[model samples]
Target: MSNERAKILIVDDDAMNRVVLSDLLSDEYDIIEAKDGDEAIGILETTAKDITLVLLDMIMPGRDGLGVLEVMNEKGWIKGTPVVMISAETSTPQVERAFSLGVTDFIYRPFDQMVVQNRVRNTIGLYLKQMQLSELVTDKIYERTRNSDMLISILSHIVEFRNGESGQHVLHIKKITDILLRALLKRTKEYKITEEEIGTIATASSMHDIGKITIPDEILNKPGKLTKEEFDIMKQHSMNGAKMLDAIQFFKNEPLMKFAYDICRWHHERWDGRGYPDGLKGDEIPISAQVVSVADVYDALTSERCYKKAFSHEKALEMIRNNECGVFNPLLLECLGDVADTLPKELNDQRTSKLSDADFEKIARSIFESTENDTENIIYEQYLTEHKKSQFFASLQHGVTFEYTYEPSMLKLHARNAKALSFPTTMAEPENNSEFWTIFGRENWDEFAKLLHDPQLNNDSFSFNSEMLVKGKKCPCKIKVQQCWNRRDPENPELISVYGCVEFFK
Candidate 1:
């Protein structure tokens, strides 16, 4: 099974050709000889798993090399096995067919022994290396996922410890989130959600109420409804949790951490714009948070708390349906409806009565140990390698990306590798810089505003270039603008956000 001594199947009608190839490869690989395509197909059907490379002949008496390749392709046997075509034929169509049929390399007749040996060895080496690299990448992805899960579990347990609960609240939220997310992936095309992203969102759901750790025990475990001042103090947890993550250097730029921060800070936001520390309405809230919000609310309604008894599944669904909790994303509500019937059974299976003090302490210690170990540096390095290779980062390294609020406020001056555009780095509010407009000029701003303000203008998206005042000189800059809004509000389609980026002409 080792690639160094992998099996090679040499298909050639000519006895001398087969002998030469076998003689060349026999020392390095176990060789199999097939006189024609039929014999090759038979051997492959019988022992394809053992073969690593194929030296196929183009010219043969019956059912030639191309025919055998067609069979291999049909059987899905051509993927891992490298096929080399041995041919004297010069016809363009014949050669193209061999290549098209997934030939790895073409070795022409009157071949030098060294050339053939080198080609076979090199092809095998290249493919083996590729396979190894793919496996390494898969392992790295698994490691990242495991670390993320462990971190979230630790944080969730901490939240439970503070509230004096069994910690099953976070687990319940994760379960419901997974079901809802899976339903969303199956039912919607409006948002592009990948399987990996689903796992990240579900794991991050455990930290949706992580901010609750900041709230005083008296407020967190009130046993009665919180007073106005206590409630207000409790609401600050979202922002506090976000700021806490922001303080960690390694977590600042991680995508998973970013999702956790968003979920923590914005899960309270309502689709109707009534709920929040930020009053961010509808789609302004990230989907990561929206999904968790529904899950958290559902779990809260259905689970026993210090202040309230667990409600029946039907009653909980009724309350959510009537918007008794708060306005939720309509699409998410649809996802909830799709999975509602099965939730009770899922919850019953996952329910935990209580967590012993020792177990809670053990989990907390493991979390602290993990933090002390600084595993984030490993994840950060992996993320950096991948991020550096991305085209988006490459573009930012050469220029700046800017987003504007519907209120016409500058979101941020985003640039990677360096400050591609000059902005206030020390001022209390860099966005207040009047010179911000100077980079794009009035004409460019007018076009951008027109796109953002007018729903009909160029289908609400446009790209153009204009001369801008950069560093006290006129410079041409490319600008792209797109209109974004809260999709939950279809009645009023006003743009709530504008994403635009500028690049200096090279």
Candidate 2:
């Protein structure tokens, strides 16, 4: 489509025909010649991705044009590469058959050079436009998918963080659910699940424990075993999570919402009619919920939690098979065994990779803007006000801007400043970060911490002078801080996070 010439492949047994066709369009296109179907098939196998169009001859020695078309169809090259039959065959049945086999156009024998050239040009142009449209659609779909995954990750991480579970628990559950569902598909057709349904179910698996957000922190993070009464309260999270999705009103009927509600409420159920909230027996539980249940239990057993040490991969698998955790669908249990060897490595890889603070904030901002709750709307407005102020201050000064959240203990540096200082854009647990401590020095950090903790200065904007190591050189800088708070409860405001900046001064 650009100035670069499109490559056209001409396949014919007659050398003269090839030369005639090549001479007709060689000025505007690069041409490749094949004397027979075998040679044409060989060229296509090696270079079909680059070849724009195929000028195939119907009657050729050793594999005819139709044979080549069949092969192309089998290899899936026919979809992207257009084929025009430049053949002597005149029968309607043969022409129809070639069209059925994916020939875009058919030219009769002794064709006019002008007609041939025009048809070839038009076909290439049409196919190019179609390909471009396909690519654009694919890109849009990919972007939507990425944003959906980011939001899901953010929501799941919030629940996991609050529940004191490993950060990778949601990811592990997602990956394991996907593997098991795919394996189940191969093992039987009892569920009649489509590939698209598999994806939806796997994605919804991340929200299986979303209800835990409603649980009290004391019960959610208790280091000791929960009492029966406390455990019963904890188990209510499933129903609570379902209620959250059910209350969304607008998207209640959407497939993802339905899947999320099912998984949230039913993932904790068991196969033997002994599981909670409404003990669904066997297939009474949706396959989506069943698969996530297995994934959740497997991840819980193999991952170290606040109350228990991690079991080995083998031990976890043994426990599941022995029904020590809970009874599961037999098909899913077998699916688990099928993927047992890959689970440990997959989970380990997930542990090492985490979302950056900038990404988390971006997702948080998006979620805040979209939430329907009045309380969240108030917080969102407050966040927007602070964010605008931060942006204005950053624009007015040549300094490093940063934000620190108290509960998660994350410090995020401005993108440019982070690059200039050779520091991570986001550092979790700044007090424990060696790089942060090295830059600010422990004494300076302690003073800063003390200042932030002082009740009298809690809501005040303040500044202090400190020496910081910048690129191995000590520089005196003035640091300004602003404390952010959730004023939803006017009488009892809560400190949420802090925003600050550092400017080097002589």
Candidate 3:
């Protein structure tokens, strides 16, 4: 629609027909030619995003125009790029079939130059306007989403501040909920969730504990275990949170508000009907609430609080898997296990300082200074690349892997490896785990610690061979360790944690 010429793909088996169409439109538009459907599809596959319109012939040798249309439909290119059919086949069935396959217009054989140019111009113009409208709507939706997330974050932080929390709880819950939902989608289509819904649910999860704002400070931040009456009073936050949302008459019917209400009211409910506040069981609980419940419990366990010391990531996960905290949906528990290895790193990243909205805008402007109009396409392409990379790594991983956080002194093992080795999947304090000490003994631990701290050893990495006391017999193994450091303050580098693996010898 701008002064720049739009690119049009001309597909036909007949060389003369392709030349005629190209000559008619090449004055106003850039024309790309393809002799057959296969060639056209190849071009489209690589440059579909750049193509503005496709002039396709109905019949050709090997994968005709209709076949090309089918491929375009499958790949979702037809939605954004307009397709016009150029052929002599004007029968109703053939035309109807082409239309059904997403053909925009048909220019009959012996095409007049003026008629061909007009149709091409109209189709491209119409699609351009439609695309512009779609982008405007998308931008509006994103703006609204950002505003809602900001308000919810501010309100959630207020509640956390009042309750004496570290203020990262809401962010942790949101991230965990998103990870769990995506993992759940991979495992089953039972929930019928979309990428957009995953984001909405994660945003709504922040308000899950908003009802705590209504509670008295004494009961909310009790230093010790609450009395029976105080516990009963404490359980009312879920219902109170729901009631608060219900009081907002204007947004009562909104989907996001409804999600927030469901999560707030039912996150405390358990899968076995043993939980308080209405005792939802099994699938009776909403998926959003179910996900937030697991996230909330995991954060609660791993986070330090007034009443209890923080458990290690390994210990918290072990507790949930064993149903020590409470019963959870088996599928959700499996989803939790799937993301277990990445959770600690993801949460730690969240703990890092985040860019403010203005900072984000400044960075975005700088990145888009040369190609401001292509910002959306650039982001979409990056997302596709990252998604492919995630899938690639997920499939590529093998053997056992584990991570240890230094401050928390928690060690987490691959779930399958933990089960195979007869070791707890997660250990809060490895030194305190009798089974852990039994397998790798205190003497080996002392030697391992000394090696890790030795100045001569590499600061980032060290390896050693040791014998594990397995089944009252010693088995030789190799241990590899990689240290993670916090370099936020370059002058005072801090050791954050280590990730390592063990290879047992036969």
Summed over model 1, clashes come to 0
* Per-residue lDDT of model 1, residues 114-219, tens digit only: 8899999999999989989999999988865655555565566567655645458888888888889899999986678788888878877888877776676556
lDDT of 2 by residue, 274-341 (tens): 98799999999999999999998888988777567889888989999999989998888888888887
Candidate 1 similarity to native, TM-score: 0.62
Give candidate 1's error at residue 391 in angstroms: 45
The candidate with the higher TM-score, 2 or 3, is 2
Cα error, residue 154 of model 2, in Å, equals 2.5
lDDT of 3 by residue, 220-272 (tens): 76657999999999999999888866654433566888899999999999999
User: Which portions of model 3 show Cα errors greater than 4 Å?
Assistant: 1-103, 109-121, 178-200, 227-233, 247-255, 271-274, 279-284, 314-346, 349-506
C-alpha lDDT of residue 4 in model 2: 80
Candidate lDDT scores, in order, read 0.73, 0.81, 0.78
Considering every candidate listed, which one attains the maximal lDDT? 2
The alpha-carbon deviation from the true structure for residue 56 of candidate 1, after best TM-score superposition, in angstroms, is 1.6
